[model samples]
Target: PICLLDTIGKVFEKVIATRLSAAIEAAGGLSPEQYGFRKGKSTLDAISKVVKTAEEACAGSRWRGGSKSYCLVVTLDIRNAFNSADWSRTLEALQRFNIPGYLQRIAPNTSMVGFADDVAIVVVAKHLAAAEELANAAVRAVESWLTVAGLDLAAQKTEAVLISSRKAVETASVQVGGTTIRSQRAIKYLGVLIDTRLSFKEHLEYVQRKASGTAGALSRMLLNTRGPKQATRKLLTSVVTSQILYAAPAWAKAAQVKTYMRGVEATYRLCALRIACSFRTVSDEAALVIAGQVPLRELIRERAEIHTAVPGRHPRGHGGRGAAGRQRPEPQEGTGAGRDSQPSDEAGTSADPKRGHGSVQQMPTRGYVPIEVEEATAPFAVQAGQAAG
Candidate 1:
């Protein structure tokens, strides 16, 4: 019984939902673990929480001298969750949360780590059996609640994964509604693919394949002399790159591996070459410079840093200024005594690459070159000298 609301009705519905959400938030009725549909929270936060918890559990087990560190993540899918919600139970839950009676009367309708309807139950233990027991208990609790609320659990669609070291990997089972969900090597949650070992190799491969297809299409359309202008092609490349780097903060650490970094860089370099309208023989560094793009590795690191800086934004508080109470170091003053002791211009300025206008810096041999270099360098070099002069 799905009812499609008219334009005016949809607007009215949004207004009411907004007010109700504001009230609930002001009342502190939601748990911190909830990240679905809440303002100022995102899927990245949920993903980060899962990753951090798993890593911490594994690390703790290692420190205690046990090779049995493991994490079990069970993702539940509710079929038609919102449409199947019982209004009476919803109002009752709201009442239990101490929501206003007047608001409850007005709300006959409406709807993560539990985003909207995607729920992931995570548990970690030193032993596989212990982890399975904990996961099963949590699943049963959620199933009970869903039953009481008149929602159907899509057992077939639900997935379970046991995250652990390769040497300690073992199989486990989770049951819901009399169906056993076996552990898989990987599971996709909120558009990111998470594997049993958290190596993110599969996810990276997935991104590479998708990005390569996009780059291939763009390459065809953005030919050297036949397609969109450089600006237009670059804009398209940026959109594709953003899609490729979605949820980077959660899995960026995997880029530390040489193989992973190379795979990502190769895909990104293809886009850069397309945007720059350069030959395939161009070096990755040169292509990125021509395309006016930073390396994917640096970009991912920057995104991770930014995510950490936002308070209550990251799942785990790493020395970030937000609520973590980490004091940011004060900027040092430029003392007159050491002004001349600074590194020579040839050594280059320490300006952040993100803030700088161009990737290329002036060097002794290179002198000052135009920030934007082209396939043919002679004319640009002459232009560079004129601009510098």
Candidate 2:
């Protein structure tokens, strides 16, 4: 009888759900910056904003307040974020924000502080020591606030990352409870690896490994099934590509990653050729034509544009490189990374005629005869690489 009554009671849940959400919003149950579980917003929005903030802070860390103020980002991993977010403590936090009400008011101490699971506290100060102290203060306050309300900080996972000028000789650490949190060169938050240098090399390598593994698995499937090449190609596009492109909108802003697009293109071309049983002499362009796969660089750029805020522009701050012009490292051989992709001042494409792999190749034209690049100079040829750098 109790089960039957429960089933019957749910019939009205639909009628009141909308009203319930509105009532909650009216009382400030959710902060504006919070996007989790909210309509018209996803975790990506939060991630993009956070990563952009990290980049800006990095720039400021290099040259803020007359060129000495660097920034520090301390990611606080509260063991069980949602499970531990006590209602009472949340209200107290609102009070700290002076969240416009008659009951209480306190000045907000942070420029950026909002997260349920992975909290990223952005501290931009003149010195590393000042930034470090600010970060620790947030932890202490939150730990005290949450502990009183039946939650505790996960000191084991909590760590700090300080980004300052390359030559800045400042180091700092934070302590939570008995746990003395140490600083790290790189830290993972929300599945993204952020380094103190913000190079994102680890992240690129991680995605490459994942995509490569998926591509290998797809290859195995091809051997077992007698299916059309289209099916295998679809699998590569949907699954393998997804693995490589996850969170690329924010991370791909690093120009050093541009060369990986070519690497990806090479991998796809090889996979397609094996299916067609094409000869080794076939060019990558021919293989891509056979597979109906879009150029990897184009694909990555399109996906990033779709998921992230403005591609090259920073979401905030005019002084920083923002996302588009963020970071471009000098291409060097032997690293197996991206090549020099500096574009001509006016032309959006890579200025140098050398295509994706950094190899100098003849750009085929209607009147021009086919010519192969000299083997000796092909591999090392760069697109005005040093002039741009």
Candidate 3:
């Protein structure tokens, strides 16, 4: 499918979108659970939330010494989401959120982390039946909302998955618009294959296959005797490697398993060997070093740390410096740098020794919070503050 947008119209759309996004953010019209098309949120954040919640639920069950816990994830498919959207409903939604009338005339545009039309509802419970019940209620709620919003839910394409650590889990299902959606062992959400145990084994295997194919294709064109130079080949290898590392932060833990690491390293080694123009017999570690490429494991860890350290994306709070602040090694006496030396802030200003770089004054307060907003009432809790002012 091809989408053609006039250059001028596209620029105008971006301007309008930016303005509308800022207004919505100020009023807190968006839910914290939402991660799509918003600043400081990504697929990694959504995946992390789901994985952590499922892990905690299963762990809680074991601690209680009773029935096992299960996490029910329902992914709903919407039919032609953008085309079917009701402009009137969107305008009304904006109005209800106390959005400026000028902005309401422009444009309108999940979670229960949605990216465009993809929406996943997650429910965790001690029993499978209870989990199913919760999932059914959530689905019904979504269906009703969609109906009112002039959208159609593609019940046939909807998928449900029951996440648990046990091998023999009783399959559970959810009812969606009179259609029964059975739970699967694994479901692909936002390009990542999430399985029952959240082990990400299937996802990693798929990545290895894809990475190997990409590297193999590039290798043929990048022969040692002819074709692209070593530097050019390495650049191409990095580009392909980045694709393989998509959502790496979410599945980094799974890479720790020896079996999983073996395949992943093999794929990485192939790319490294090609870049270094080395023999196949070279060790994976030596090949990566020779190519001046970071090991896959270390690369994944570094990416995960960066994701956590990013200001708005930090899981704990706004000011967390993540691994950078916590894990930075102290300077030795022989080194010119002092132990008390402070890192420069993003603005290039030297931070005070007493206060870390990410002090309260430096971190701006975020507009969105985790407070629940009932659809029946006016959305955007921040609207109250705006009204009072």
Arranged by TM-score with the best first, the candidates are 3, 1, 2
| TM-score of every prediction relative to native | 0.73, 0.61, 0.75
Q: Candidate 3 — which residues are off by over 4 angstroms?
A: 1-11, 61-68, 105-115, 309-389
lDDT per residue for candidate 3 within 94-191, as digits (tens), equals: 67667777766444321001126667766666667766765665566566656665676888778877888776866898898898889997888778
Q: Whole-model lDDT, candidate 1?
A: 0.62
Clashes of each: 1, 3, 0
User: lDDT score, residue 226, model 3?
Assistant: 64
Pick by TM-score: which candidate is best? 3
Residues 34-117 of candidate 1 have per-residue lDDT tens digits of 555556667776676677656655553452455335667778777775456455755665665566677777665334001256
Model 3, residue 58: what's the lDDT? 62
For candidate 2, list the clashing residue pairs, or say none. 61-70, 61-71, 312-324
lDDT value, candidate 3, whole model = 0.62
Which candidate, 2 or 3, would have the higher lDDT against the true structure?
Answer: 3
In order, candidate lDDTs are 0.62, 0.49, 0.62
Candidate 2 stretches greater than 4 Å from native: 1-20, 60-68, 80-116, 167-171, 255-282, 306-389
